[model samples]
Target chain A: MTRVRVDLNISLDGFATTADQTPDNPFGQDWGRLTTAYVGTRTFRERVLHDTSGAGTTGVDDEYAQRYFEAVGAEIMGAGMFGLHEHGDDPEWKGWWEDEPPFRVPVFILTHTPRPSIEMKGGTVFHFVEASPEEALARAVAVADGGDVRIGGGPSTVREFLRAGLVDDLHVAITPILLGQGIRLWDDLRGLEAGYDVTTEAAPSGITHITFRRESRG
Target chain B: MTRVRVDLNISLDGFATTADQTPDNPFGQDWGRLTTAYVGTRTFRERVLHDTSGAGTTGVDDEYAQRYFEAVGAEIMGAGMFGLHEHGDDPEWKGWWEDEPPFRVPVFILTHTPRPSIEMKGGTVFHFVEASPEEALARAVAVADGGDVRIGGGPSTVREFLRAGLVDDLHVAITPILLGQGIRLWDDLRGLEAGYDVTTEAAPSGITHITFRRESRG
Candidate 1:
């Protein structure tokens, strides 16, 4: 069974994304500021930025950033993450990523209006699905083969999976910045820590990485 | 120049106290569970519990717990923290603490109905005052005698001081327990991190200690 995992960058006030997000400023004023710790990592530079210059920090933040891409086969993300909401009806909007997206596996994009699957270069394929979290997870799990299914998020998508108790492990990098108003990750998910064994590690980049792994009932 | 400091034990969801708080259950259902890290520390056991046996954990948690009383002279707390709400209209109500409270200086209780000052044993004195955060801080600072003024909290009072930006340093211990509903300490205080330099340290006891020190502007 492929375990479901989620990794999110959240503010100290629990906001995963800012309220001022728009087409022009998708992540709002604090987007770049909040993700600086991750984006400055060597793994993120190579994987996400597709930079071959061999730049970026290599420490605790990089260690956690490297783990984010490890042991994950397929991914399930919301429409917002795919930039479908912002660039409505724009066929040109493949995704925020370049020609070769980082997943290197089948990626399921959950949207209300489903579109035909788009297979990109470098072993990355986008499958648009209009299904519930359970259905979506099954589809992603099937595509995942033997590896884990990662729940790529914009906060709401992760909240849905978490509320359904589908997530087996969660990694939250709490940035020191405060977005104040945005979509909260912890709303309505009270007593969430009871089912999980939690551990926290503070990185030198001023970000606190909190990991929660589900405890086996047996 | 007496710096105002605050120390609170909060849940992962940012709750300091639960809704079911009462005289019988001071900290509600999660009191003992949430405060286990602090109460189990050698500093807390010695200062607050008045135990001189030198028992309890001696590590990161204890180091942070010890700072709760270091370099501080006076304390300012809400009426709810003093148990005035539960035991109302009783002049005989001295306080929940015994004769020698942990605080060895003047402690101001912010209440609507002010009462006569009661000087306790062991250099501790309780004074009831109907004052705002600034007014109360002024009084506490004066009595602090150049030491810091500690904002002892029940959440709402701390919220007021935080909103006013009177706190110079804040230490919050994020416990592993999750209390779903309660008075949140981070509510209405958005963009609070912008004014301070924040750092996080995780302890072996599974509690993450977050510190925020106000940045000095020359």
Candidate 2:
């Protein structure tokens, strides 16, 4: 039974993304501020950035950061996260990530422009498809191969899966900052704590980690 | 010198109020769930509700609840929170509170229709005025007399004070619930965490209390 999980770093105002995006700095200034705790984690420094200097935070943030990469057979993300819109529909765009991407599993990209599966170094394989949230999850779960199917986000993509009741565990790191604008993560998720056992833990670095796990996980 | 402070209970999605308001139950259904950790505090039970049973929580929620009433020489609230919209200007509505209101301070109500001061049984005094956030804060600070002037809110009023840079301390209890709709407290207040030293503490009851105190106090 592969559980569907989500992890996002949002502002106190519930904004998952910042409004200060420019061509020079695509992720925006506040994006760095919003993810200060996560990026400072040893796991993030080693895994995502491929910087194995062993120089990063190793507390609560790193604990969740470790859980982020642990036991996720497959991943799903939006076109924006995959930078398909930024790079255009060119076949040469292998994604914003490095040659050896982070997720070493079947990574499903939700997009309108269908593309051939791009197999990168390591285990990450990007599969582009135009499908509904259910269809996307089915493909991801099928390829998950018994590990948890993680819902990698750009906010809206994660919202779609959450609204469809496909998420088993939702862990949101609420960083103590106000982005005031941009995409909000909790816009349409009213009464989302209905069936999930919600728990929260505040890290010393001023980020609160709130987890909502399904009471009856299959 | 009187410092301007604010205390609010908001959902994880940043909604300060819910949309389930009806004639019978004015506060809406999710309001209770949103403020469960708050109203369950010992200080809230005693100070707000006047429940002398001494039967309430005495944890992190209670600690903050106690701080909510400490040294509050005066308060400024919106007409909505004052129930002016619900109850017409018959001059008979003594603010929907009991004869002895919880706020034993000069309560400034921002309204279009000004009314003479109404002195309640306790030290609570309702003074209706048609002034901007600055003007209202000025009046409240004038009466504060060395104690802190609290910006009591219905979301918008607090945002006004926050935007005007009149707040010295802002403590928001982010309850782990999503209303999905209603008044957002963090709108238009971009980069609100700028100069303030932000901190967070997650309670066992699943409420994360985030505080932002101004680094430089006048």
Please list all clashing residue pairs in model 2, or write none if there are none.
none
Model 1, B1-218: lDDT tens digits are 67889999988777888766677885577777788989999999999888899999999999998788888889999999998998758998888888888988899999999989999988889999999898998889888988889999989999899898888898999887667778888888878887788888989888888999975321
Best by TM-score: 2
The parts of candidate 2 lying over 4 Å away from their true place are B215-217
Clashes of each: 0, 0
True contacts kept of each: 0.68, 0.99
Maximum-lDDT candidate: 2
Model 1 root mean square deviation, Cα atoms: 2.1
Model 2, B60-93: lDDT tens digits are: 8999999999999999999989989878557788
lDDT of each: 0.87, 0.90
Model 1 over residues A1-218: C-alpha lDDT tens digits? 57889999988778888777678885677888778899999999999888889999999999999989998889999999899988759876789887989999999999998878888888899999999999999998887878889999979999999999899999999887667678888888878887788998889888889999985322
